[model samples]
Target: MTGKSEHDDSEREFDYRWARDAPHKEPSARARMLAARWKENPPEPVPFRGEPEASGPRRSSWISTALVLGCVAAIILLLGYTRFQAPY
Candidate 1:
């Protein structure tokens, strides 16, 4: 009888499950995480520059050489000089 009465104490506590039914107002996981990050720090807006920031000079010096060489070849071909090998 003593053992059975001792175990009944666990179940005798008042439950407030009905109190939680008022609104169940709680932030969602995302909202909670966002709030925690906001509290820890502050919100920062993303930069929206009109033109995308260039990483660096994308064109290499060799590309300029190739372009100049192509123009020279065009001028040479237009001058009616026949080459041993076809331009193609």
Candidate 2:
């Protein structure tokens, strides 16, 4: 599955250029209508920040638990190895 017997040089180039340089223009009447509507009913409020303390404690608890588990696993592995070591 390949070129102009299918789709080759000129067609492929045309498609690429069409996507890159397509014009986007709203008609003048539509633009004026939008401006008039916005002049009366403005946009709604948007809060950008979250509750810092709410997330902070949870993140710290997760890190602490992960560290504890990792230490416990390492200790278990060390004990297992010691139990099987050949005495010299």
Give me the candidate number with maximum lDDT: 1
lDDT tens per residue, model 1, 1-88? 9988877986786557855775767778999999899998988776676667789868889999999999999998877655535485
Overall lDDT per candidate, in order of appearance: 0.81, 0.76
Clashes of 1: 0
Q: After superposition, which runs of candidate 1 have C-alpha atoms over 4 Å from their true positions?
A: 1-56, 81-88
lDDT of predicted model 1:
0.81
Candidate 2 residue runs with Cα over 4 Å from true position: 1-14, 25-43, 52-66, 69-84
RMSD of every prediction: 14.5, 8.0
lDDT of 2 at 29: 92
Candidate 1's displacement at residue 22, Å, is: 98
lDDT for 57 (candidate 2): 35
Model 2 / residue 43 / CA error / Å:
6.5
Root mean square deviation (Cα) for candidate 1: 14.5
Model 1, residue 55: what's the lDDT? Answer: 92
